[model samples]
Structure formats: C-alpha cells, structure tokens
Target: MSKKSKSFFSHFTIAHKITMMYGGIFSLSLLIISFFVLVNVTVIEQNNIKAEMKKTVENIDDYIKNGGELSQETLEALLENKYIEVNVVDVKNHKVYKNSVGKLPSFVRQIQSQPPHGFLDEERNNRSEELEKKGFKVDIAKEFNMDDKAYFISSRDGKEFVLLEKEINFEESCYLVQAFKMLQKNDYYFRSFGLRLFLIDILGIFLSFLIGRYISRKMLKPVEEIQQTAERISIEDLSQRIDTSGPDDEMKELAETFNSMISRLENSFQKQNQFISDASHELRTPISVIQGYANLINRWGKSDPTVLEESIQSILAETEHMSQLIKKLLFLAKSDQNRIPVQKEQFCLNELVKEVVKEMEITTETKRNIIIKEQKTVEIYADSSMIKQLLWIHCENALKYTKQNDSITFHIYEQCEYGCVDVQDNGAGMNEEDVTRIFDRFYRADKSRNKEIPGTGLGLSIAKWIAESNDGKISVESELEKGTIFHNAFPLKKKKNQKYS
Candidate 1:
C-alpha cells in the first residue's frame, strides 16, 4: 500500500534528525565558546603588552636617574632592542632632541611638526640649521606633559602606543624626558592569530558534523532493520526477526521487543488457522451424519416409522451438538475479547466444594467412589459462580473418565497465600501428551473424537478460562492408565471489591 505524505520535518529519517540536531547544537556551542575564548585571549595579550611598556618606562626613568643625558646617543641606546622611540626637550633653550638615522615605524606615534617658533630664534637659525643638517634636534614634537607618568596614545587606525614623559633638573635647567613603545609587531600578531582561530573553528565544525552523522547512523541502524523486517512480514510469514546480538542498551531492548512481537504474531496466526481447520472438521462429521439420515428418511420414511423416528432423533441430537459447540465458541470469543464481567466476593471454598460435590453425586448417572477427605474452610476472594463452574468441569470430567468403582476425591485447604482445591481421580488417565493438550479448545484426550465419549471437547478449555478469569491457577497431573489430578488455587488476599472484566 502507498503511504500518505507527511510534513516536511516528518519526512526526515531518525538518523538524519539525530545527525542534524547533534551537529547543529554542538557546532553552535563551539562557535560561542570560541568567541569568548578569542576575546579572553586578546585581553590577556594586550594587558601583557601594557605591562612590558611599563617596564620600558622604568628603564627610561633609571637612565635619567643615573648620569645618562637625553641626547642623540641616549635615545639611540634605548632603541637598541627596537620597537621604541625616544625624545628629549631642553625646555630652558626651547630646543628638542630625538633619535634619527632610519624612518620610524608607521604604527608608532608620529611627531607632528608644530609652529617653528616653539624653538628659540637662535636655535632655529643657528642650532636648528646645523642640527637639521646632522639630523639630531628639530621642533617636531607637538605636545608634552611633565606630570604624565605613563599613558597610551592612539593612532588614526585604532592602534595604540605606550608613552611616558618626566622632567629632570640638569645644569640648573629643566629638561623634559619622553618615551614611546611601538606596537606594529603586536598588530601583526593579532591579525595572524585571528586568521588561525577562524580556520580552526571551521575545521572543528566540519569534523564534528561528520562524527555526528556517523554515530547517528551506527546507533539508528537497528531501527532501520526493524522497519525492513516489518515490511517484509505479511500474513503468510512472520518468521523474520531482528538481530539482537549486541550490548544490552536501548537499541537492544527495541530489537528484542520487535522480535517478541513477531513471535506472538506467529503463535496467534498458527492458533487461528488451527482453530478454523479443527472447527470445520468437527462440524463436517455431524453434518454428514445428519445429511445421511435425512436422505434415508426422505426415500423411505413415508412408510417406515422406524427410519423417520431415527432421522428426527439424529437430526435433533446433531443440532443440539452444534448449538453446544456454538455456545462454547461464543464463551471463548467473549473471554478472549475481555468482555466477560467479574463481580468478586470473599467466600469459603470448603462449603462451595461440598455443595458442588454433592450436586455432582446426585445428578451424575455414573457412580464413582466420591468423597472429600480434607475440607479446611479456607476463605478466598474470587467470583463464586466462575469457581463453581470450574469445580463442575473437573467433577464432570472425572465422572466421564472413571468406571463405577473408581474413586474421585475432593480436597480443599490453605497453602501460604493461596486457597487450594484438588479434584483427584482414579480413572483411565492419559499420557503426558494428552495431559498437555487437555486444556486446548476442542482437544480430547482420545484425539479421535470417540462417539462413546459423549463430549464436545470444550469442557477443559472453559475450565481454564474460568480458573484464570477468576484470578486462579489451574494445572493437571496425570499418568498413563493411573489417574489424573486437577489442582486449582486462588489468592487468599485480594483487595476488597477488586473486579476484572
């Protein structure tokens, strides 16, 4: 049969859904964690740079504290390790001194030239002209703060440079000292680091997706097998089962459950086919007999009264047998459908058994040596009517199988939590095979459906339903040519007003 279309999401198989969910959630989580980690790492790197700049500031301070003067040589000495520029101002003469020789890194702070008058008149014309030729002192620094200990200065491109300036008393004149830490290398490090991080994140997402898909497929393989097995199974075949040889996990449990369902389907199908075949065979006999008699009467009964009477009697008996068979079938049908109602009450088994035994003795045509050897007044909770019928099924079977002198005994007593009854018979008993099949529908110990047996072969089946429906247990013990014992047990303790329908 064609399947109906489902929603878009429903069209996805379980494996696909699992893969998508696992991969999507984990990938998103990885991205978020990577973002925070990147930010954290950047902050720590910047902080370390700031700390190194402070160390450079202290080095410059120590240089001034000693006898080192802020000249061209002083600035050159500080720039020996690179990434730092220096400046000095002879404020009393309105002249500044700075390092020279090569172009400064563009990422470092640039010395913006101010009005030339920031320098002395003689310094610009005489000292500035001579120093400009030698590239030692010039009026290019635009600002200064003698009180500023350490500070950061930013360029137009969002890059930072650390700077510090202080005043020194030298030759009875105040000299301004300044320092700048270049950060071009740090900028390069950040750009390269960010690129690597982005690439690694992408790779991680790809690998995670592949792993999720593989694991989902492996885990959901059993579910796929179950679906295939079900599709292959039809009314004609239910023997296919999922492989359950694996670790005891949820997947294993699901496989076991699927196999169990298949087994039950096979059993039910077998029972249904057997029931139809047996019912037809049982009915065909009586039907053929009735037809034969009717033919006998139809051709000759107008003049022969004997044949007419025989036909009518045989027809009525067959009809009655069919009716009895129908009633038993209906009982089983109702019981199987769980339509039979239960009304429970506490009752004494001894009194009920005594009454049943007495009734059987009085009504039965066959006289067995019947007696109740032990009758302990054990109270049990169950449906009394069903129990009565259950008792009668055993008693009637005993009467049917035994001779006039064989003994049939009834016993009732308490055993732990159960109230028990035993209907034991000394009769023409059966073998293990017959005993095993005695409770099956339309099953006779004789197996041949003997006419002399006088039974519809439904008594034991009805007896089993009665015992189970009334919340009791029933079992039979028999030996070939020895005897049979039918044991029934019911719970002595059931909640008041417990009902089963």
Candidate 2:
C-alpha cells in the first residue's frame, strides 16, 4: 500500500477497523454466493428452454405425421404469444412450405445453406448408402447444424434464443422443421434478482458495521475508564482508583490491578510522610540541646573552669547522640535503597552469642545478672559481623531496660530446622500494642518515659534488617511491667566438626 493509504488507516479507531473488517468480509461472501446462484439459475433456465424446444418440435412432427396441413394461421394459433417462430421446408422441391414470417433473416438463409450435423446411427447411414447404390434414394442428415449454440445470442435485436432442427418423413417425402424460442423472460428475471441481491447486501453490510462498532465500544469501555482515572491520579493524589464493577474478565482484572497499584502507592506515601515527620522531630531535639550547650560555652568557657568543663561534656554528649542518630538514619536509607551489601559465611551462633554476652557484661558491669541459660552447637551461613551487631543491639537493649538485681538471660538452641538465639530481660516491658510495632523505625515504647531512655529507637529496626538480610526472622514477646523476650532464628544451612565453649 501507499503511504497515503497507511496514513488514512492509521487515523481510524479500533471500532471503525472492526466495522470495516466485518462489513468487507460479509459483503465479499454475499457476492460470492450471488455469483454461484446466478450461474445455477442460468444453467437451469437453459435446461428448461431445451425441454420446451423439444416438446414444440415433437408437436409439429406429430401434426405432419397425422396428415394435417401446415399453414401460417395454424402456426400462429399454436405458438401465439410464446415468442416462438416455425418454418417448414420441402427438401425435394427446395422451397419453403410454411413460415411464420413473410421474409426470413439473412442469417437464417446462411444457416439453412449448410447441411445439418446429424451423424446419428452410423449403421442407418450405411443402410441408406447401400440403398442408394441399389438405385434407391434416401435423405438422411443431422438433426442439428454445425454452427448451432446451446443459446444463440443474436446481435440484431440483442435477444437470446434456442434454435432446433428436425427431419420428418411423411408419405415418402422429407420435411425440415425449425423452431426458435426467445429467453427474454429469463433475462428479465436475472436482472431483477441481481438488483434485489445488491440491495440486500447493502443493508446487511450496514447492519454488520453498526453491530461491530457497538460491540467494540462496549468491550473497550473499561479501558477508556482506566485511562481517564489514571490521568486524574498523581503522587499527591494516589487514592483515586478505577471502579471495577463488571464481569470477571480481563478488563475487570486490569481495572482491579490498577486500583491495587494505586492503593500500594498511597500506603507508601503515607509511610514516607510519617518517616519525615518523625525524623524531623528526633533531629530537632538534639539540635536544640547542642545549640543551648554552644551558647552556654561561648558565654562562660574562658572565664570559669567548672562551667567550661561542664559545657564541653554536655556538648560532647549531644554531638555523640546526634552522630548516632544520623548514622542510624543513613543505615536505614541505604537498606531501603538495597545498597547494603552483606558478606555471608558459616559462623557458630553459640560462640558468637557467648562473645556478645561477655563483651556487654564487661562493658556494663552492672548489678543485673546476665546469665547464659542454654547453649547448643548450631552452625548457620550468614554474615558473622552482621550477626554480631544484631546480638549486640539486643544485648544493649536488654541492658537498658533491666534494673539492678534483675536477670537478663541468654539461650541458644536449634528449633524447627533453625539455629535460634533468645534474649529475655526482667525489665520495664511494654504492652501488646507496643510489641506489635516494636520493630518500626523511630518507634519507642512508653512515650511517657521515652525522654528518660538514653538511646535512639533505631537499634531494633536495624537488628530486624540485619536478620532479614541474612534470610532470618525476628520476633518479640512482651507483657506490660513484666519482661520482654527477643528471639532470632536462622536456617541451619551448614554443619561441620567444630565446637565452641
């Protein structure tokens, strides 16, 4: 096709394309059927004409055999209004005995001049030849001529006719009888049939095009709605969803999927907003403390030794807190972006847990008793440093909440195909609601006492990420004012002949 044709078609919608496809296919099919019908009808009409011509020839032959005289009046009376013409000839005299017309067409004379192509019954012709050689005579010729057609379409009057010839033997004389019948009625019938079929095809194509357009639009309605709904949605307004009220089909599924996407986006945006608010609040407190310490140091640091020393210590503490907070924030940001790379290796959980317990014990040296309740030889594949950091976080958390004379117990065992670590503290435990959200970043239990807690709330959140990055799980159980138990389980993926005490 040309570029112009392609451009033209590209402008058409899917509905229009469907309509045109249906209309073109149906119209082509109709034309093919009509063509076959025309051929069949023409053949049937030809057969009918042949049968009628046979009967008329037989009638004239019978009349001659019955000794009835032939006349123009008799011929007209017999074949009136039938569009039939007859002619009788005397073969011996070479003269016209009877004719429907006073003068014959020049074409008719040309046809009569040639002998008929009767070649029927070779033995009869042989017999006639034998008699002629024995001084007897016979007039045997073909019943049809060489130039005859099944249908003779005459150009003189643009009419269709069938021509037939027969030889009659009457009282030892031969007579030639010719019959002609025009097919004007059959022609008229075909013309009328073609017109009706064309009209019907036009109506059928129009209806098909209309029906195709309607169905295409109906099917694509949901897609249009999806586009419209999407156009109205933005990061600021992700709550808008496409309505999915229809049959359980692909369109409905698409709409449902679109709505689900929007819902996820909305949830993520909400979390992002909350994170920003909480981060701002947490950073603002340390900033205010540092600013106050700087103002105090600037006013009295050079003049008074005690005031200068106090301000330096206070400033150092605030700076350390802010540094820890910022580090935790950066760690979480990298984890969220999947930029934290973990180096995994086989490590002894029992040995690692014992080391963390000993280190934390030496660092605190508190009145609280940190006890190792149980130990097991369980090997797992994970980043040893990450696991150590995780254990440290949990131990530090346990130390923070537990008071003097309270016991912080540690346990290591294999449970359900996992190497497990459990840290139980007899400290200020939280309620069930706090336990549920304990791992959320920046979430601290007992907001009333949060100011007294001397640590950032990102420890447990970081611990959770470390465990999950190593394909492990963490869970916590706490009861208000009773205690909290933190559990870590890693899949026992490797085993070897190694021991640790």
Candidate 3:
C-alpha cells in the first residue's frame, strides 16, 4: 500500500477518543434495541408452540373423559395417523393393563412428593419406592413443556386411571427446537454486534472531520490571496491591489481597506520625494551667490565700510534662509518617521494661547496685531512642547502671509466637537487649487510668492502632521487677496471632576 493509505489505516487501527465517546453511546443504544427485538421474537415463537400443543392435549382429554372407553384398539381405530400412545391401568393389581408399544418414563411415576392437583416428576428410584408403598397404579410421560413428550390424563371408574401419552413430532417441530436452542446458546452475540456498530460510528466521525477541513481550506482562499498581495508590496512597488471579489466578508473588507491605505501611502511617498528634489535644487543658487559675493568682498574691499556692510548683511540673510530651510526639512523628516512620542498632561488652553501670541510679537518687524477674540479656562491632555511648536507654525504662517498692519485673530475656546483655535488673517489668500495641496511638503502657491518669502514650503505640512498626531485637524478657508482662515481643532479631553453642560 501507499504511504498515505497505510497512514490512514494506522489512524483507524488505534482507538480514537472521539470514536470511543460517540461509539460507546451509539453501540449501547443499538445493543438495547437488538436485545428487545431478539427477546420479543423468542417469546412469541415459544408461546405459539405451547398454545398449539395445549390444544391437541385438550382434545385427547375431552375424548377420554366423556366416554371412559379407552382401549388401545379403540384409540388406534379412532386415531389412524395421530401421534399418540394410550395405556390402561388396573389400580388394584398395581400394573399396566392396556396395549402400549412404549414403556412409561420413570420420571413420570415418582409423583408422591407433589401436590396432587399439580404436575410432578418421578424418576426410576422414586417411582419404584412409590409403587411398593402405595398399591395404586400411575402413569406418565418423560418430558413436559417441550414438544418432545406431552400427554392427556383421565380417570375410569374413579379407581383405575387411563394415561394417553402423545409423541408430538413434526418436521417443523425439530427445526423450531433446534433454532430455539441456538438462540439460547449464543445469547451474548449482541456484544459483537455492538462492536460492529462502534466501528461504523468511528468511520462516520473521521469522514466528518476530513470534510470539515476541506471546507475550511476552501473558505480561506480569499485570505490567502490577500496575504500574498501584501507580501509582494515594497517601496518601489506600492501599487499592487488585492482581488476582493470572493465574498463580502471580513477578508474582503480588509482587502479594500489595505488597497486604500496603500494608495494614500504611495501618494505621500511621491510628494516627499518631489519636495526633497526641489528643495535641493532651489538652495544651490542662493548659496553659490552668497559664496561668490563674499569672495569678491575679500579680494577688493578689505577696508571699505559700505562694501563690508553690504556683503555681511547679504551673507547673513542667505545664512538665515538656509538655516530656516534646514530646520523645516528636519521637522518634516521627524513627522514622516512618527518619532514624536506625545507626553500627555493637563494644561490651560487660554494661558498657552497668550504665551504663543506674546512670543510672536517680539520677533516680527511688521505691525501684525495679535487679538484673542475668545478665551476659556479649559483643561486638556497634550504634549505641551509639541503643541507649542504646532501653534508657532500656524501663528508664523498667518503673520508671514499677511501684508503689514494685517490684524490676526487667535480664537482659543471650546466648540461642540473640539477645542477650537482659529487663526484668521487679511492678506494674500490662496486659490482653490493651492488650498488643496498647501499642506503638502514644498508646495507653494506661486513661484514668485516663494521667492519673496524664502520659505521651505514645509511649515503647513509640519503643522498638519502635529495636529493629526494629536488626534486633531487643520483646515483653511481662503480667497485671493481677501483673507485666509486657518482653523486648528483639537478633540476635547474629559476632566476628572467636570461634567459637560
């Protein structure tokens, strides 16, 4: 046999625990049902045989009792083919008197110990003793109950008794008796039958397990496909999508969600790469100009104050711009890695907003007014340091983009869903297209705007990252030259003892 077939057979050869559990229950039930059937059949056949024999015995009794004329010649003449033997007894002589082909069984004569009205057994010794003691005659047949020997008894003249024994034999009687004995001998066959039932139950259980495993494997096909699709995705190949057409189950939903996440990740990665490439190219020209102008001053204007002042101021501005760009790039890199682990603590929202507004006033030359239209003493969980950085980006962006004397409003309070912070300005507002990609890295509204501001274009991107990391959102409403509204919304944190009104 093949190895698989041999292994399968080996499993059946050893007893299985489940097989024993279920098989034992089913086998016992089967044995009980079989036993009932066997017992019912045995009882019915025995009853029928006894009923027919009793009928025949009753007929002989009626004939002998009515006439008191029982002779072997008369009995022989009356019963031409009947299976019977008749005997006449002389009570006074203590001997048999009528024609009889067979002698009486000794067991039938030993009847002294029995109640006179009931049947009794008298074997040879007991019969001889009884005959010597009582001077009365008696006769009987050897067997009772079984069909082999049965008889009819009646009295003649109140003293002499007549015994007519029948030899009850038919072709079917022998077969019936043999069958009954076989049934009695092998009465424990049900145990073997229970064993066979156990084997069948074991086979059924094994089949069910095998079929269940096959169905499970077929059902998991979609999941296996999704795993393979995920494995194939890499930095270079982030565009692969899983087939989600099998069924609308959890696996299908997972595949769809995975595809959506991959699309977002691919777009984000592409934007990052474009920003790095553009930033590198844009910085080279200004750096080269600063270096060239410095070398010119060192060669020809060693002691000229005007030349020295001009070169120094120009070099300082270039250095500052470069420093700002480098800082923006580093911040973007940190956000990309999700390295900013937040430190949660309770803090006052109103106080923090005042601190930011006060700090922004010190560094700017523009007459940008800082107005706090709304203030509330709300406490919330946040990383104070990161939140301050996030506030700085928004405040600085509003200040930088607005023209001189543009009033900027900083609203710090609570809304229905979040702790609201709205930074609105009346300056160069963005168009629809620009607002969409404004929070993207190195994305500027116009090339002329970027040149005037000398920005790295990552201010809004870093601000947006901080907001999202803290489970908040940043949005804008703007129109060209009219104004821009930068809304910073943070989800409110529940206080220990304070309840919502």
> CA lDDT, every prediction?
0.74, 0.75, 0.63
Measured against the true structure, the TM-scores of the candidates, in listed sequence, are 0.71, 0.68, 0.54
**Model 3: lowest-lDDT 10 consecutive positions:** 174-183
Reference-based lDDT, residue 82, model 2? 53
Which 10 consecutive residues of model 1 have the lowest summed lDDT?
137-146
Better of 1 and 3 by lDDT: 1
Question: In candidate 2, residue 496 scores what lDDT?
Answer: 49
Per-residue lDDT over 380-425 for candidate 2, one digit per residue giving the tens place of the 0 to 100 score: 7788898998998988888888788898888888888788989999
lDDT comparing candidate 1 with the true structure: 0.74
Tens-place lDDT digits, model 3, residues 129-209? 454345434444343454333322222323322232332223222000001011122344555655665676567556655
Tell me which of candidates 2 and 3 scores higher on TM-score.
Answer: 2
Greater-lDDT candidate between 1 and 2? 2
In order of TM-score, best first, we have: 1, 2, 3
The candidate scoring highest on lDDT is 2
Check candidate 1 and list the clashing pairs.
none
Q: Answer with 1 or 2, whichever has the higher TM-score.
A: 1
Question: What would the per-residue lDDT of candidate 1 be over residues 1-501, giving only the tens digit for each residue?
Answer: 234545666889888888888989988998898888777776676556555544555556667677676676666666534454556666665567765334543422223454244333333235334433543323432333333445444555554555555556645665555566544444667778778888988998898889999999999888888889899999988888888998899989999988998898899889878877887887888899899998998899878999899899989998888887878778877887788887777898998998998898789886789888665679998889989988988887888888898999988888878899999988888888998898989988774535586677888999888878777899999986789999999988685575443
TM-score, candidate number 2: 0.68
